[model samples]
Every structure is written in C-alpha cells, then in structure tokens.
Target chain A: MSGLRRGSVCLGLCLVAALTANAQTDAPSRRSGYHDMGKPLQAMQDDDMANPGMLWVGEGANLWNQRFAAADKSCADCHGAVQSMSGVAARYPAFTAGSDQPVTLEQRINLCRTQNQRADRLADGSRELMALTAVVAHQSRNQPIAPPDDPRLRPFIAAGEALYRLRQGQLNLSCAQCHDDNAGRKLAGVTIPQAHPTGYPIYRLEWQSLGSLKRRLRNCLVGMRAEPYAPDAPEYVQLELFLMDRARGLKLETPGVRP
Target chain B: MGNAVHAEDGLRPYRIVGDAIPAPLTGEAGDPERGRAIVANRRVGMCLRCHSGPFPQERFQGTLAPPLTGAGSRWTEKQLRLRIVDAAQLNRDTIMPPYYRTDGLERVAKGFAGKPILSAEQIEDVVAFLATLKDQ
Candidate 1:
C-alpha cells in the first residue's frame, strides 16, 4: 500500500511540473518570448531610477487635462476619464486606406488631433507627441498587444517576414541571425533578450530616455552592418505589422522601462 | 580607455569568437582598404563600434568586444573569414552576428533589395584586414 501511494505521489509531482511548463509556454495573452512582463526594468533594479516614460506620461496627463483650442477643449474634455483610453495603444499600427500603409499609434494620435480636435498634426518626435504617446501607452500597461487582424495588413506582414529573413550590408547579417538564433544568450556582459514586441516605446537605460520601436529597429539594423531604414519608412511599417502579429497575445507595456 | 585591456585581458579566444563553423572562403586575395571601408560603412561591416582596429577615424569603440589587433596571430585567415561570415553556425548560442548567410532575415533595408548584405569580394577584403592583425 505504501509503495502504491509513493508512485501516486510521484505521478502527481510530474503532473504539476508539466502544468508549470505549459503555463510558461502556452499562456494566452502573454507576450511571446519575453523574459518578464508587467514589471518595469526600473522596478526590477535595486536602485531607484525614475522611468522616463512615466515622466513623459506625467507631462501628457497635464496636457490632456489642460485647456486647449479657441473652444477651450482638451483631450481630457471629451475622454474626461483616462482609463477609458486603456487598451487603445495595443490596437495601433493600423491600416490606412488612402496611403495603404500601416499607421502607427503616433500617427493615429496625430490624426485625431488633425481631424477631431481641429489642431495641427504634431510633428514626428516632438516632445508633445512623446508625452501623448507615453500617456496612451501607459494606459495599456499589462493589456495584451492585440494588433487588429485586418486583411489589409497581410501584405505588410509578409514583407516584414521577408525583411527579417533577408541578409543586408557587407557583413551580410540578417535580423533573424541574432534575435532569433542567439536570443537569450549572453553577449559581452548583457543578456540578449528575445526581440519580442512586449516592451516597446521603452525607456532604455543606455539612452537615458524613452525611445520608439522604430529607434530600436534602426539600432538593430546598424548592429547588423545594414543601412537603417528611414524614420517612419514603409519597410519599418511592414516590419512593425509583422512584429505585432508575431507578438500577438503579449501585453502592451509601452513607455516601458528597460535596461 | 586603454586598448591594452582589450588586447591582453578582455576576452579568451574561445569566448570572443565563439564556436564558429569552418567554411571555405570564396575570394582569392584580401584588401585592407576595402576591409577598412567595410568596417566603417554603417550599412556594411560596422566593426568600429565593437572592436578597435587600424581605423584612425573611429575614436569610441566597445570595451565589451575585444580589440582586433592580434586576431591574425590567434586565428588563421580561413577561420577568421568564416567567423566573420557566420559565427552562430559554429556555436548555436553565439552572440556574434553572422555576416554572410543570405537566408532567414527580416525587414531588409530597401537599398539591399534582392541581394546579400555583402558580396563574396567584400568578405574577402575584411578577412584580409583581419589577417594583418598580428602580435608584434
């Protein structure tokens, strides 16, 4: 009877181990290939380094609440509440019919200003745009990055996949060579995090400020000895669409803090 | 700050180059100037960022990756060439980016349409420069 009971206990332990591994690998709404989620790198650090994205979000909240326009309308006037904007950032990099390009959250936010608020489109990389984007991204913290699966974006995703696989520059390195093959390996002193789309618009400690996804992409290209795409380029847009799809079900922690 | 640390103590031969697969090079002779260009070219080699070399134009280089002065003494021309081309093929878990393989890349820059990042000639040139790096 005791031997039978021991066998049963071993089986139970094995089942528990399997379940834990499954939870890690097959967890729905979890970012694919990311090490840690929800917690900012700042929080992970023993020392207190204020998150730059949070700083920008504070500026955005002020801008949202402050009065604007001749009608004295502000972003918060209609949205009034901040939490309603939650989950909004995750659905971005959307398709545009006229341009036939995947529009990023920054472009969409600017479009709202131009169309609804009767305001000029914010210049790309402006402080105001950063603040606005930070606030929107902050709202979507922990929400899965559910890039809308519209048929229009299929071509871009395909293009991005091709780009990810193709070699570039004199060194002849591809994006997949490092991010996919050597991911999670130690390079020099830093651990190579899998190039997942979970923590984007991140505040990199190296940069000492918040940076957009495009910036990171450009950095990768440079690292590969490949010429970087122009800012807001079509190739990058296609790549972003593909990344969003690949990172499907991962939480959007935009304006995220990262080492 | 000093190149001595990178040259003397920074990396072990096994660690810096990683487990690189040995492959036959496709070019005949190497060109150091072309190699220099490849190293400097942001769209090509971009070696100046990581390893300090004969490039006088570059000032700030990475301490994490070792200097490439005595590379030729440490590794043969063919071995250095293969490592430059694809370090990951030898070691499945190497952080060094593979430079020559044409398969499985994403979001290639528009200028590199339908072509490998570098031609066989360029790889030879970079290898030539690496061959010049010997401990004197």
Candidate 2:
C-alpha cells in the first residue's frame, strides 16, 4: 500500500513538473482562425479551383509579366519568377535600411514599383494591388510565419503590443479582451478568433471579394464603434508587425477564404 | 442640471451623482415589456452579444461580460439607469457601450454622428426591465 501511495505521489509530481515546464516555455496555445471555420469553408479553402480569391491571383500573374508604361519594365524584369518569393511573405513587415520604420509587404511592393518600375503607387484597396499581393503571398502558402529578428523592430513590436492591449471606443474593449482572453468563446453566434494575421489578401464570404489585413482591421474598429485610422497610418503597419510576430510558426494561407 | 436639454447634440440630459444617475432622462417611468423586447433583440440593445443571462430560447449568448440573471438584486434601479446611460462613468474599461450620451465621442459614422445608441425613453425602459431581474 505504501509503494502504491509513493507511485501515485510520483505521478502527481511529474504532472506538476510537466505543467510548470509548459507554462515557462510555451506561450498560450494558439488556434488559427481557419480551425474555427466550418467544414464547408475549410473545403473551399482547400480547393484552389473552388476558391474565389484565385481569380485575383490569375490577374496578378498577368500583371507580374506585363510591362509598365513609365519605365518599360515589368516585375519579371527584376524578380525572375513568383516561385522565388517563397517564404518571403513569412518574414515581412521587415525593417529595410534608409527607411526609419518597418514596411509591410504591400509597402515593399509599392516601393519596388516606384523605385524599379517607375510606376505610380497603387491605391490602398485597388483591384490591381490586391491581385498582385494575392499572387505574391500565394507563393508563401504553407510556410510558417517567421517575423524578422532585427533589433530595430523591437520598439515597434512593443508599441503594437501596447495598442493591442489598450481599451478604446464607446464599448471600451481592447483587442486582447476578445482575441486573447476570450478566444474560442462565442459572441453573437460567431466564435471570437485569436486575431492572427496568417492570411492576407483573403477572400471573405461577407465581402465577396479579396481584401487586405488593413480592411479587416478597419472592420473591427468600426464594430467597436471606434474611429479607424487613416489608410497610410503608421499604426496599421505597427499592428501588422505585432500580429505577424504573434503568429510566428503558424502556416501562411494567402487568398484564404473566411466566412 | 437635473433635467436639462443638451443644447449641442439635442439629447435629453440628466445629471450624474456618485456612481449612479439619480434621475431618469424621460420624466415618466418606462414600459418593462418594451424594455424586454429591446434586450432580447439583436439590433437594438445587442445586450446578448456580450452578456449571457436568463435567456433560454436565445442561442449563442456572449461570454464577454457578467450574466444578466440577477441584475436587480445586485444593483438598484438608479444604478441600472446609470449603467444603461453610460457604464464608463463607473468603470473606465467596461465593454458596455453608452446607450444614451452622445457628446465626447470620437469619429462616429456620418449617419450616426449625433444620435445616441438608444433614446431617453429606451434607456428608462431598459432600466425598468433590468430592475425586474431579481432572481438568479
């Protein structure tokens, strides 16, 4: 009986040790928004031919090869093939030299356009831009999100964390309150997701079109009855950086479908 | 002011005392039946979006805030009125939206700029209904 008691106590001690180790090493377990989706939506995401966002991807392929009017240069002139950009989207919102702040993948695309192709910057929600972003991000599908480790990005990441936690709007709820604390719980028949930015230029069934992360962020702000930041606001980029870092190791799913 | 009209936004104004609004925006008491309808509705009160309560027929109630089962026993009608009017007065970080006040808000949508979420009568009615929830 004493031996059995000792064995039970040993098992309890092992359990406690395992739990402590998990708490010390691992952050809270993360579930992507995809998992929270219904099976039909998952099936839609799985089949590229069935996915509506692929229409934009096809348009992007055409745009990638077409010559720009200003410089007589196409995106293919500099970057050989779209496939070469694999894992590029995963390490985005990176701090590039000469620019003091970090730039999103969309910004990088615009920068390349203005500098290399001598083309005008595309508008925030333009179809051409969305198409191009969709195609480029599609190359990184299934790659784990890998936020860069530049020291310069530390302060911006910290700021993003602060904004995520800060309560605002007439509702006075923070992003962390819904996404972090109460994730997996129901709110008006919809499951509150962890707000990870693994997908971009995604096709939302509600929108019936592909949209960037900024558009979704704006929707959340409006839902909270808060004033959304401007299109070119640094706050949006900062938030994107924070979300990417938060979603490290999660697989990318550009042109993703969400209900 | 006890029952002043807010000249800026044209909303009926009431004074705040301590943690509660002592006076109702509408002079007369509100209908509890109408109040219950608003509370259960998805568009009007949106109460069930963040709060679960004694609502059995309603599916998918929220888990963000406290349940509304025993609101009457927990707080007085005056306190409930203040909460419905503007909960931020009591707790700065309360997720509850201010259903009455219209001023000091930022970047309201163009159509809803000056309009409060609920009318003065609606606020009173909701308060009345909440006061009847004595049983847990």
Candidate 3:
C-alpha cells in the first residue's frame, strides 16, 4: 500500500510539470499588468463602495462656487444647483446629434464656453479648466457609467481600444503594463492605482489642482515616455473612449483627490 | 630609419611636423570675461545650484549634479555646448534641468520668446572659460 501511494504521488508531480510546460508554450499574448486584470473601473465603481475620495468633490464644488474671469459667470450661475446636474455626466462620451461624433464632458464644457458663456476658451488641462471640469464631474457621483447605447459609438470605442494597445515612446511601455498587469504593485514610490476612471477632477497633490480624465491620460502618456497628445486631439478622444469602455459600470468620481 | 637623411645632398633641414592637429578656436567674440559675469550673476544662468565651479566663496550650491571645475578638459567644446544647449537632447534619462530651449517652456517675457535662457554667444563664452581648465 505504501509503494502504491508513492508511485501515485510521483505521477501527480509529472502531470503538473507537463501542464506547466504546455501552458507556457501555448500562451498567445503576454499582456502587461495594465490590461490584464480587466475592468478595474467596473470593480472600483461597483464593488468598492467606500467614498474615500469624496473630499476632492468638495474642493471641486468650492472651485465651481467661485467666480470666473471678469464675466462673473460661476458654474453655479448657469447650472443653478448641482443636484440638478446629477446624472448628466454618465451620459457623456456620448454621440452628439449635431456633430455625429463622440465628445467627452470636457469637450462639452469647452463647447459651452464657445457657444453659451461667450468666454475665452480655457487652455486644455489648464488649472481653471480642470477645476470647472471637476466641479461638473462631481455632480455625477453615485451614478453608473453606462455604455453609450448609440451605434455611432461603436467605431469610436474600437478606435479607443486600438489606441490603448498601441505602443509608443522611448520606454516602449504600454498603458496596459502598470494599470493592467501590475495594477496594485509599487513602482518607484507610489502605489499604482488601478487606472480606473473613477477618480477624475482628482486633486493630485503634485498637480496642486483638480484635473479631468483626459488630463490624467496625458500624464499617463508622459509617464510612459510618449509625447503628449493635444487636449482636443482625436487620438485622445479614441483613448478616452477605450478607457471608458474598460471603466464601464464603474461609478464616476469626478474631482477625486489622489496622492 | 634614424631620422634618415634624404638621398638628395644637403637636404634642407626636414621640418618633421607630426600628425596634423586642429587648432583651438580663437577670436574676440570668445570672451571668458563675459562668462565670468554670467557665472556670478544669480539672475542669469544659475548653474551653480547643481554644479560647483571656480566661483570663489560660494557656499550655497546644491550638490545634485557634478562639479564643473574641470569640465573643459573632460569634454570637447562641441560636447560642452550641447550640454548647455539641452541636457535632455543628449540623454533622455537625464534629470538635469534643460537650460536650452528644447520645448514646453511658456509664459516667457515677450522679447525672449523662442530664445534659450542663455544666448549662443554666452554659451561660447562659457565654453572658452571651460577650455582653460586643461592641465599644464
């Protein structure tokens, strides 16, 4: 009985070794940490119910409450109240009935600037612009990030995912590496947040101001050693669309503060 | 061939000049005096922060970068100029703040737009000063 048991144990070890070798040889794509642990946005939005990042929302609110330029048109003046602004954010990355292209909330705000407020355009990712963006995004707290139901959004989403996977820059690291493969690991000094879109309008202590998802994406590109895309560039829009898809179902936390 | 006398009788004292060497640059525009003024001025090129130079009695220098005292001897004039023009252009991994107008700088005074912090003449002057550091 002892001899039979020993033989069975040896057979089990041999089987495990063969399976490991087979798995290694058959593996098709070796994706990095960023894209591997898929749908972190959904998890952060759905499962991580804690609102630890709410303080940035308050700061964004304060920025919104403040007057802008010489126009004295605070976001509060037009929107009237923030509670009324809720649920408007999740509908973004939406197809514009006019342009027939997808536009993020930041672009929409710039549109409001050009058409409604008659104000000078805010430089993309500028502090004043991001502050207002954060304030607006903050209004959408607790709402689900629903996929853009329009068929027009399909091409844009595909474009975005393609951009996400494309390699760029001297380091040759992709967004998928850190955010997907090593999402929670320590690189350099800081903890790599799951690259979920949950924290937007986040007050990064380094930035000393609130910023939008696009601004964060630009920063990520810089971190990846790639030259930054212009704020209104189509590549950024495509990447944003892909990021939103990855973050599908995650709750929007505009104006979130992060280390 | 012990300094072989040529077959021609009374061969004129053969001037045996060795391998041709490039002559050092020289001109009135190459002024180390101006370079001295720049090195001492706090409002201008503040290279002293990251580097130590021949500047006397300056105790407030930060040591983030190496000393530049013997830089002329260590690097060629062209190499030193590139270092001053844009450290990033030379090495992507360098942490040294780029003094040259490579990119991304904005909000400059109107007259200084598209110009490096230090002018090319100023760079030439600095290079002249650095070139004096060669050992005897």
Candidate 4:
C-alpha cells in the first residue's frame, strides 16, 4: 500500500515537471513587431503627420460622423463622440451572448451596420471598411491587448491555437514555425516578425496602402503557398483572438507603418 | 511509360522509385556553374531563404531548416533530385516547397497557377549544383 502511494506521488511530480517545461517552451517572451523595424519606418509610425495610415484614420473619423440615409443616424448618434471608444480595440475578438463563436472587430462593425444602422455592409478590404476600422482601432492606440475573459471563447481559442500550429500548403510550414520559432531569423534579407496583430489598418510599404489584419493574414497564407480562408472566415478571427491573447501585455500600435 | 509528359502543365514527367527520381527531368546534363548562380540569386532559386551553405558573400540566411553544408555527402544525386522536385512525397510534414510540382496545390496565385516554381532545366541545374557540395 505504501509503495503504491509513493508511486502515485512520483507520477504527480512528473506531471508537474512536464507541464512546466511545456509552458516554458510554448510561451516564449512576448515582443511586438514594432521592436523589429528600422528607424525611418518607426518614425513614420510615431509621427501623426508623417504616417500614411493616418490618412485612413482621418477618413474613418468622417465616416463615423456622416449620417447614412437608410438609418437616418450617424455612428456618433448611438456611440457618441468617437473618443468615447477609447480602449475598445484592445479587448476584441470577443464573444457575443447568442453567437456560438467570437466576432472580430470587423465583423462586429458589419453586424452593427446591418442590424442597428440599416446600412449596407462594407466589403472586406474596401476603402470605407478599412477607413472605419482604422478610426476605431486608432482609439485604442498604446493600450495593451486584452482578450476578453469568457469561458465561451475557450474552445475557439483552442481551435485557433491548433490552426496556428498546424502545418499546411505545399511548403508544409506552420505559423508557429515562422512567427514563433524563427521570428528573429532572416528570410530573403527581411527579418521575420513575431506577428502580433496589435496593428490593424496598418500601412505596408510593399502594399503602398493601408490594409486590415485579415489582408495581412492572407499575404502570409499565400507566402506559404496555402489556400487562404475567406475574408469573413471564422479561422481568421479565431487566429486573431489567439494572437491578441499571446500578445496580452503588448501595446497596440494601430495605423502602424511596416516595411 | 518511362518518359511520359504531364499534359495539363506541360511538365516533363519522371518516374519515382524507392525515394529517388532515377532519371533527370531534362534530357541534357545541367551546367554546375549556372546551377550555383541560380541557388545564390535571391529571386531565382530562393534556396538561401531557408538554407545556409558555402555562400560567404550572402549576408542573411534562414534558420528554419537544416544547413546545406553536408547535403551532398548526406544524400545521393538521385535522392537530391527527388527532394528538389518534391520533398512532400518523402515526408508529409516537410516545410520545403516543391520546385517542380504544379498539381495538388491549393489556391496558387493566378499568374503562377499552372506553372511550377522551377522549370525542368532549372531543377536539373539545382540538382547538379547540390550534388557537387561534398563534406569538408
């Protein structure tokens, strides 16, 4: 009886050691892509006047106040001053009560447009959609990414984590392999980033335009030679959720500039 | 049956036997000097994007996969041919891209839809170059 008890104790100790090792390896120290940029690009992101993404942010401010004919009301009517939305973008990809899955900030905006404003939904990557998302996300600038704490989002987070780790496409590379394991390494003279989604509606020098997080995700999928999910695919939002959670303490840098 | 042509993409077909493509894709032998140039050029072979080898002139090289220093010593010419053609046939989870395969791929860019990343001649060139790298 004593031997059996001692054996169980050893097993318990072994489990704890395994779990600790897993946590250490899986959860590397969090660092934002911001730290990896050159001086000029970082300066561009910092200065409002110099930043090209601020162009969209300005347009977003206009759209926020403009009254739609169908709804006979502006976003400002219900939500009030745009500044009131401060820190809203940080806690995104959150669960809604009736919905089985979490909704991305983009999806939530579309839902509000269709349901409350009676306005036509904006297509993904459209100028108007990017403008509006930039304005909203810009409000949460410098705030730490804070994923919502709800049990309903647990399964979705797990699914997102699995997708991030799953090897796909002809190249057979996982997001984790590049963004997590080999982030600091160089690929074709460009440094691979940890790929935190703190900056959506970011302006990429390669694109020469402001783009959403989904658009960036699509770019990576294509780079890996994989079939990317659709614009409104749940996979993107789930992955976004996992990323926000992964970058829990990092400050948001919306309207960010990237080379 | 041995030298059948793939109809859709017009790729020169070669048979796979026991983890190696026993024959070359192109009928003629490849030029090793030209092959070395293709591997080093960033926009061409993209080999250095995921591998580091004897190229001292190149500043940045990837760390995602095994180094190519002893590749020739480690693999035969036939084995290297198959790997450059398509590593997926050997290991399903390999991160190496198939340089000479076009089918069974998902959502390839419109411009690159039916064309392989490297032509048959380019594949042979790369194979020739890789085979020359014996361990020091």
For residues B1-136, write the lDDT of model 1, one tens digit per residue: 1112111122111222333323334426768888878877644676655566655666555333567889989888767865776565566545455566544444455555345446567887888888888987
- Give TM per candidate: 0.65, 0.82, 0.49, 0.77
Q: How do the candidates rank by lDDT, highest first? A: 2, 4, 1, 3
What TM-score applies to chain A of candidate 2? 0.89
State how far residue A89 of model 2 sits from its true place (Å).
Answer: 0.9
Q: Candidate 4 regions off by >4 Å?
A: A1-28, A97-100, B1-28, B40-44, B52-79, B82-94, B98-121, B132-136
Q: Write the candidate numbers in order of decreasing TM-score.
A: 2, 4, 1, 3
All models, DockQ values? 0.13, 0.50, 0.04, 0.50
Fnat per candidate, as a fraction, reads: 0.14, 0.47, 0.00, 0.46
Local error of candidate 1 at residue A92 (angstroms): 1.3
What are the chain A TM-scores of the candidates, in order? 0.83, 0.89, 0.69, 0.87
lDDT of each candidate versus the true structure:
0.68, 0.85, 0.60, 0.84
- Residues A1-259, model 3: lDDT tens digits: 7899999999999999999999999974322222323354334333324333344445556766666565767667887776667777766777664666788877887776665566777787776666566667767876766666788888888988777765454334456655665555544324455676765656555666566777777777765446677656887777777776777777775545455
Clashes of each: 17, 0, 15, 0
**Could you report the Cα RMSD, in angstroms, for every candidate shown?**
10.3, 4.6, 13.6, 8.3
Which one wins on lDDT?
2
Question: CA shift at A247, candidate 3, in angstroms?
Answer: 1.3
Q: How does chain B score by TM in each prediction? A: 0.70, 0.90, 0.66, 0.91
Candidate 4 interface RMSD after superposing interface residues? 3.1
TM-score, prediction 2: 0.82
Output the number of the TM-score-best candidate.
Answer: 2
